[model samples]
Target: MMRRHPSHLRLKPLAKQVIVITGATSGIGLSTARAAAARGAALVLAARNEDALKAVAEDLSSKGAEVAFVAADVGREADVRAIAAVAVSRFGGFDTWVNNAGVTIVGPAEQTSLDDQRRLFDTNYWGVVYGSLAAIDQFQNQAGGGALINVGAGDVALPLQAAFFASKHAVKGFTDALRTELMAAHAPVSVTLIKPSGADTPGKDNARNLTGAPIAHPAGIYATPLVAQAILYAAEHRTRELTVGSGGRLLALASQVAPALTDPLLAIGARLNARIAKAPDPARIDNLHHAGRDLRERSFQPGVRETSLYATAQMKPKTTLGLMAAAALAAGFAFKLGARKAAPIDE
Candidate 1:
């Protein structure tokens, strides 16, 4: 039902407008890439995974989407610069660049490693910094207006994942200031910030770099298709700021209404999660593909099919009531299943 937006949307004037995506090897990056590709955008995928990048490119190419990729780690300035270069070389220049490369660090602050803290800044925060600078310079060079979108998480904050939260918070602040600076100077290129909840991503397993805390909540059988869709829509519309997930919106609300109350509560959650939450240890986690224990085991509905990220965004006045009813039934059914599983073990 989502018709193509017209050639103007696709071409965006001049030659094919390139789309640059960091952390394009997996998770929301990969999914978002697919969405953009479907919309007829040429892609310049950036990631540390050369083989994976090739595979994605080939797969998408087979489907008739023009794609190219670079093996660059956004954590490093040089690597990020190279990534931008690849995009310019391959497609001339990008119309949109997505800063999505990031890592998660979970656990208590006391136990978190300095190495992880550094990496968190490197990938989660500095990655955005490096990517932004790279994109801005390219936009300036091309003398063309483009966009920079930084993929974010949760709300403005989350106590348990202090390091992770800090990284995102840093991004949010940096982006807000950058947005204002650009506007003040009247730069044609735009900046956007995408705040999504813990999505259904392989990043959950790879993010186990922290032995102390967790980087994110595990994804279950049901994924946040709507959130993913929101990112794509935001990209199309060139929206400045976006928040995904009901929980994410609620967290924003909580932060505003009662910071004092939320702060202590978050601190308590952080403390408890440090000892509990028995997720993967830093050593056990890998950046490569690894799906952790199924979050769906607790809440999966047998007959319900997953809603695609694209579908998730389509639920408006037209689709809201149906979604809510289905969600309510799903919650109750999931509880019933959980109780049944627990009762036998208790016996």
Candidate 2:
């Protein structure tokens, strides 16, 4: 549970903020770098790929955005600390840190190797833990507090990617607990979790595919810019959690209200989606062991529609919550009506 803070809290302007982002070479992290830089924020980009980091830094620099790069793996605590160290060295103290580095293993829980599962948690869960701790420490030492944002997936258990979903849930749980602790301590730092639904990114090819099937992000895929928008918003303002897309939002609600129904539905979807009979070469296809350097903007998959549900929901929380509740009520009422029509008439 994210604790809401007073609206009067002061935050530094985007132009003056020194932001550090992990997994900055590609996907949401890369998009976030571009967005934040355009806002005049100084950026420190970190990833395991040195060449890709240089390319991103050069591109941002050419566009006159203050930027630096650190080639480090988020899975290592020392490397994560080095990212903060670079921010201080280049831009003199970081104001916002986005822990966006994560990986996935596409396969059933039984089929996915234990080593692979542990690796997923190391990057998804432990990476956030390490980055948050570093950012909080820096915020405590500084005069003004800062924002710590963790880019997490929707908080729902899905099929085929059991470990990946579990890792995401762990991230949410850890983030909530950290928020509670920070509030109790009266710390000025703000922690936020940004959960984006399926987006068309290289993540499909970037992950370890143990299922021996072609894997891709779920339907209703939105572009990465939408997620970057939410990330930038949370950086300048205080946000508890932001879920980005109607598809993800609906799935989360379904999982919460009807897990029995959603469980099998999700399983069936995953099984059917994994029907592509080709397998990716583990050594060349996966970035689980090392950093991947194929950095690009979008995956460009066909037949998927985009949405702005997340951005709208972020801008209007009360309206969004009310609409979601109204939808639930409408669904219940329709079910009752159908039941009445099916029942034997009293004659």
Best by the TM-score measure: 2
Instruction: Assess each prediction's global lDDT (C-alpha) against the native.
Output: 0.68, 0.84
RMSD per model, one decimal: 11.2, 6.5
Clash number for model 2?
Answer: 0
List model 1 lDDT by residue over 213-251, tens digit each. 544343332344444466556555656776655556666
Residue 87's lDDT within candidate 1 is: 81
The segments of candidate 2 whose C-alpha lies over 4 angstroms from its true place after superposition are 1-8, 276-284, 316-347
235-314 per-residue lDDT for model 2 (tens digits): 88888988888778888888889989998887678767855333444556588888886686567667455668667778
Best by lDDT: 2
Q: In angstroms, how far off is 25's CA in candidate 1? A: 1.3
Report how far off residue 322 is in candidate 1 (Å): 18
Cα lDDT over the full model 1: 0.68
- Give TM-scores for every candidate, taking all chains together and pairing residue i with residue i: 0.73, 0.86
Compared with the true structure, model 1 gives a TM-score of 0.73
| Residue 33 of model 1, lDDT score | 76
Q: What lDDT does model 2 reach?
A: 0.84
